[model samples]
Target: MEAVNLNKKECKFVVAVDESEESMYALSWCLGNLISQNTTNNLVLLYVKPPPPVYSSFHAAGYVFSSDVIRALEKYGSDLVKSVMGRAEAICGKFSSNIHVERIVGSGDAKDVICHIVDKIKADTLVMGSHGYGFFKRALLGSVSDHCAKHVKCPVVIVKHPEKR
Candidate 1:
C-alpha cells in the first residue's frame, strides 16, 4: 500500500464524480486546494452512469410499463446529475475561465474507465471521496475511489469522512 503523500495541485488533476456525498466532498476539497487563486489547471469531473436495466423479453412490453417506475428513474438520474453539477459549480465558482472544468458521463466499471482516462489524458493527480463505506465493504465491493487509488498511476486524494474532512 502506498503512503498518503499526494501533492496533486502541482499538476493536472482528475477527480471522479459520483452521486455519492463522499465523492462530492472530495471534489470540493480538490477544488479548494488544487485550484489556486491564479493558475490554470484542468479539473475533470467524471460521472459514471449505470447501464440501464434491459427487459429480457419483448413479450413483457405488452403487459404495460409502470409510468411511475419510469418517472422515478428519470427523477433519480436527473437529481444525480444536478447534484454533481452543483458541487462542481460551487468549487470552481471563484476561478477564472482558464481553470478548465468539465463533466463527463460514461457507462462502465468506474475503476477501469478512471484509470483509462487518467492514462489517456496524462493526468498527474486524482482526487475523490471515500464514500464512507467501511474498509471490508470496500475490499469486497470495490469502491470507486479505492479502485482509482489502486489502479491509476497518478497520485490520488481521497476526501475523508465528514469528521475527518
Candidate 2:
C-alpha cells in the first residue's frame, strides 16, 4: 500500500448523482479515470431530491393529501437516496479502497444544491454525468452540468457514455 500524506488534508471530490444511469456512469468514470491512489481523497456522493411535495390550501373538491401518503412519499425518497448511494459505494469499492466515501442528501434544485455543496465542501473537483441532451432539449431544460461548469470554482468534469456500437 502506498503511504498517504499524513500532513495534507484529504482532497475533496464531489460527484453529483441521480437515479439516471448517466449519473451512475459518471460516478464509475470518476472512480476509474480521475482519482489516483497516491493521495487521500474524500469521495462525496451527493443526491439532490426535489423538495417534498407541497400541500396547498386549495385542492380539487377540497380534498387534501393524507399524512400517511405524504409520509410514504418521503420514505420513498429516502429509500431512493440510500439505494443510489449503495450502488455508488459498490462501484467505488470495485475500483479502489484508498479513498474515504461520504454520502450527502440534499433537497432542492439539483443545479443549485450541487453548486452550493461543492462550494461548501471546498471540493477540488466536481464530477457529473451528461444526459447528452441535444441543443434544443438543453435549451428547453437547462443542463445542470453546463450550469455547474460555468458557476463552480473548481474544475468540473462531465462524463458521458460512449455510443453503442
Candidate 3:
C-alpha cells in the first residue's frame, strides 16, 4: 500500500447532488467522514439540470402555447436548482460552517456535466451517490457514477445509501 498523508492540506472536493435522497445521504456521509475541521477543505456542490426539451411553435397536439409554456418550464428548472442548492447548503451548515462551500449549476447530461466540471475545477476528489440499480437496470439505463468514475481523472467516491445496502 502506498503511504498516505493525513496532515492538513487544501483539498477540493466536488460533490454531485440531485433531488434524490441518495445524493443527500452521500453529501452527509462525505461531511461526516472525509472532511476534517483542521484541514482547508473546499466543498463544491454541483447540480446538473436536465437539458431543456426541444419544442417548436406548435406542439404535436397542435397547441400554440409555446412561449408561455417554455417560460414556465425554464422558471421551474431554475427554481429546482435553487431549491437543491438551498438544501445542500443547509446540510453543509449542519456539518461545519467553516468549510468553504461553492455551488455550481450546470445544464446538460449529469454524467457529462459532472466530468467536465470536475476536470475544469481540478478537483482532488469527486463524491457522488449511487442509485443502487441492479446489474440489468444499470446496464440498460447506464450509471452516471460509473461513467464518471471511468472518465474523470480525479478519484471518484460513490456513496451507497445505507438503506440501499
Candidate 4:
C-alpha cells in the first residue's frame, strides 16, 4: 500500500448516480481510476430528487414561496435523497475509499443540476456511465452521460460496462 497524504485535501470530483446498475458500476469505476490509494479529495455522489407537485418556483421574482412551503418541499425531498444515499453507501463500502464521499440530492433536471453542482464545487473530474440501458431503456434516459460529457468544462469520464456476450 502506498503512503497516503493525511494532511492534503484532494480536488473535488462529482459522480451523478441513480438507483441503477449503470450508475453503481460507473461510481465503482471512478473510485478505481480517479482516486489515489489515499487522498482527501471530496467525491460528491449526487442523486437528483424529483421535483414536488406544488413546488414550482420559477427563476423570476414573480413567484414567491413561503418559508414553510420551502421547508416542507425540502423536508420531503431530502428524506428521499437520504434514503438513496444509504443505498449508495452500501455500494460504496464494497470498494476502497481513496476519496471522501459526500452525497447530495438536488431537485431539477439531472443533467442541468449535475452541471451546476460541478461548477459550484469546482470539480476536477466528472464521471458517469454511458446512458444506453441495453437498447430499449436507452431511448428514454436519452443519454445523461452524453449530455454531461458535452457540457462540463472539467474532465469527464464515461464508464461503460462490458458488452453483453
Candidate 5:
C-alpha cells in the first residue's frame, strides 16, 4: 500500500456524490471515519451530469422543440447539482466544519468522468458508495464504482450502507 502524505496540510480527497442515499452514506462515512473532524483538508465533492439531450432530425419536420425546453432541462440539471451538493454540505457541517469542501460538476459517463477528474486533480483518494446490487442486477446495469476502482490510479474506497431493520 502507498503511504499517504500526512504531512501535507491540505491533501485532496474526492468523494463522488449523487442524490442516492448510498452516496450520502458514503459522504457521511468519509467525513466521520476517514477525515479528522478538527483538521482542515481539501474535500472535493464530484457530481457527473448526463450529456445534453440530442435533438433528432425528425423533430424539425413538424415543429421544432422550443429553446424553452432546452433551457428547462438545463435548469433542472443545475437544480439537481445544487440539491445534491447542499445535502453533502449539510452532512459535512453536521460532522465538522474544518473540512474545506469543493464542488466539481462534470459532464459525460459517470465512470469515465470520475476517473478523469481523479487523475486530473491528482487526488489522494476517491470515495464512493456501493449500491449493493446483486450479481444479475450489477451485470445488467453495470457498476460505476467497480469501473472507477479499476481505472483510478489513487486508492478507491467503496462504502456500503448498513442494512436497515
Candidate 6:
C-alpha cells in the first residue's frame, strides 16, 4: 500500500441542503466519507429559500389578504430556514469538530441559487442529495442536481440515500 500524505491544500466543499431527509443524509455522507481530518476543509452549508409569493393586493375572489396574513407567511418561511440550518449545524457538530463550517441562506430558484453560489464561492466541489425521481417525474419537475452538475464550474456529487427494504 502506498503511504498517503495527510497535509494538502485546503479544499472548499459547498453542500446544497434543504428541508429534506435526502439532503441531510448527503451532508452526513460527505462529512464522514469525503472530508479529510488532516487537511483544512471548508464546509459551506447552503439553503435556498423559495422566492416570496407574488400576490396582488386584491385576490381573484375579490378580497385582499390582511397584512397579518402576509406577515405570517413570511414568518413561516423564515422559521423554516432557521430549522433547516439548525439541523445541518447539528449534523456538522456530530462530525469532526476540526472542519470549519459556514451557513449561507439565499433566496431564489434553487437551481439558480446553488449554481450561482458555487461559482461565486469558487467551491472545489458541490455536493447534493438525489431525490431519486423517476425519468418521467424528473423530466417534468426538472431536477436541480442535474442542472447544477451541468452548470456549476466545480465537480458535483449527487449522493443517493439507500432505500430501506
Clashing pairs in 2: none
Best by TM-score: 3
Candidate 4 residue lDDT tens string, 63-164: 777777778876866675666678777777777666577887776667777788888888888987776322224327666777888888888998876652
Which ranges in model 2 have alpha carbons more than 4 Å from their true place? 1-9, 54-63, 132-141, 163-165
Residue 90 Cα positional deviation in candidate 6, in Å, after optimal superposition: 0.5
Clashing pairs in 5: none
Candidate 5 wrong stretches, greater than 4 Å: 1-6, 37-39, 54-65, 132-141
Evaluation by TM-score, superior candidate among 2 and 6:
6
Lowest-scoring 10 consecutive residues by lDDT in candidate 5? 131-140
Q: What is the TM-score of each candidate against the true structure?
A: 0.69, 0.80, 0.83, 0.69, 0.81, 0.83
Instruction: Tell me the lDDT of candidate 5.
Output: 0.79
lDDT score of residue 79 within candidate 4: 74
When 2 and 4 are scored with lDDT, the better candidate is 2
Residue 6 in model 6: shift from native, Å?
9.4
RMSD of candidate 1 to the truth, in angstroms, is: 6.0
Error of 2 at 10 (Å): 3.6
Candidate 1, pairs of clashing residues: none
Off by over 4 Å in 4: 1-9, 54-80, 132-141, 163-165
Query: Model 2, range 55-150, lDDT digits (tens) per residue?
Result: 333344767777777677667778878888898888888974588899998877678888999998899899997762221233246788888999
Worst 10-residue lDDT window, candidate 6 = 132-141
Q: In lDDT terms, how accurate is model 6?
A: 0.80
RMSD of each: 6.0, 6.0, 4.1, 7.5, 4.6, 5.1
Residue-wise lDDT of candidate 1 within 40-131, one digit each (tens)? Answer: 67788776654454221222346545667666765776686777777776767765446777777665555777788888888868887776
In model 6, the clashing pairs are: none
